[model samples]
Target: MAAPTPRALRRGEISFKLDERTAHSSLDLFKKDTSVIYRIVGIDPTKVPQNIERFTDWAVVLGDTAVSSGRHYWEVTVKRSHQFRIGVADLDISREGCIGVDNHSWVFAYAHRMWSAMLANKTTPISNIGHPERVGVLLDYDSKKLSLVDVSKLELIHSIPAEFQGPVVPAFALWDGELLTHSGLDVPKKLSGN
Candidate 1:
């Protein structure tokens, strides 16, 4: 399917910040908690207090807000990162393992110079068209669909259909770069049927 224009995606944009409590120890969040980067010299695990809500093993973080209904859109600017996963996950998704390897999360990943959509340990390779500096995500809750877009090229990377059990939050995992999120945008005119 053709991807909507970036202007159209702005219609459904939402505002959210990363939830520090949900971030992994190796991730450092800044820019009002809307950006995250993986730190080579992570905070000593022993110095950080234990929190069951924290992502213990993965360099992942979740948005502070959850989407329970309607259509929403957000974008992530990947800066100087070669390996990362961007997607949404259920509130109850496991924090131990990687995001896309479990049933509760779905991701569009860029790693090892390959792009793929992953869920529940299943991967479907996507043809690479260079790399995107920005990724746009569309979550149509009522439609039960999640889509990833190449923001600069205005191309659809992939879309997934699923029966979301409950509210889901913006989820991300980074290995070597930084991510800055953009939200509170209007849904694109094309997507809004205008």
Candidate 2:
């Protein structure tokens, strides 16, 4: 029998600043070296500027932002297969400081489609949390699944299945002592994962 292949390490990355718009510049998640930025389309850390080309890690372009170890806020876009990810981070670029501040710029990239091109890669592509205490849980388009994980620990907290509608992306909210979401479909289902 053939030996099983080991799970590949999912590399995430992002360029970030402490407060580009609301406050001064800083990367709180900074540790010793640059951290990988992941993807999360719709969630907290809202009102970010649009139309900026997603950060390129494999790009050969000059002057691209370098990965640093520190705390920083960013707009994360998950790009494992489609390469459509964006976000910010405060990296430590040092590679020596292992412990990081991680105000939680470590973005999450999930999809409703289980067979999404991104999933083909090794990374879990977690969703970004909305606040320091809140989380960023999104629906995968391919797999039609929902997962909630801690942005700091990168632990899978919750997960559920959901399908894709059309142009409208699924938006989640907590109400009536339950977690419900607008499925971006005509008849939205009241989803509550146990």
Candidate 3:
């Protein structure tokens, strides 16, 4: 019998930061880098700004704002680089492991021309999608649905139902000199008194 041919895997779209508004948007996430290398330039009426970074390794950062309920959406720009992950995770998930390795987190990964959704250490392949210049993320906490979108063409890439145990925060990971710029952050209104 003849050997079977390898199944071709579709490569996800590579995106760029077309939205210049981020330069003035309010950033809700930052980390202790060699310096304050990351910054937010602008934000929308919702007060969510784009997260921008030139690309670094072994770095994980969480949004200062936490969302326990309601629907949320955000965009990430990866002007360059093919290895990075973006998603939401529980406030207490271990940063040591991969982003989507456990039930504590749900992340979308794109590399080597394939897009996959990971949760609870399970990975699902999403096909027929090319790397776009931008990717949008939608989260419906009440319904436990998380989706990834091709922002440049306004197309749906994939959606997964997630059962989260507690509050979740937007999470980002990058390494080996890869840069990712993300936009759209849901900022909660602060009360007058603590």
In terms of TM-score, the best-performing candidate is: 1
TM values, all candidates:
0.89, 0.23, 0.63
Report the lDDT of model 2 for residue 111: 32
- lDDT tens readout by residue for model 1, 1-194: 43221111122456788988888989999999999989988889887767777899889998877787788888999899999999888888887888899889988989988888898989999885557788888888888888887677655668887678888888999999799999887666555541
lDDT of prediction 2: 0.25
Lowest summed lDDT window (length 10), candidate 3: 5-14
Candidate 2 off by > 4 Å: 1-132, 170-194
Instruction: State the lDDT of candidate 3 residue by residue for 1-194, as single tens digits.
Output: 43222122122221222222211222223332111122323224245432332111224555444556766666766645466677887766663555788888899987776889988878899897777567878767777877887776555678888897877766665432333445444411221010
* Cα error, candidate 1, residue 61 (Å): 0.5
lDDT values of the candidates? 0.82, 0.25, 0.56
lDDT of 2 by residue, 15-92 (tens): 222211111011111222112222232222344332122221221001123222211112222223222222222221
Scored against the true structure, residue 146 in model 3 reaches a CA lDDT of: 79
Select the stronger candidate by TM-score from 2 and 3: 3
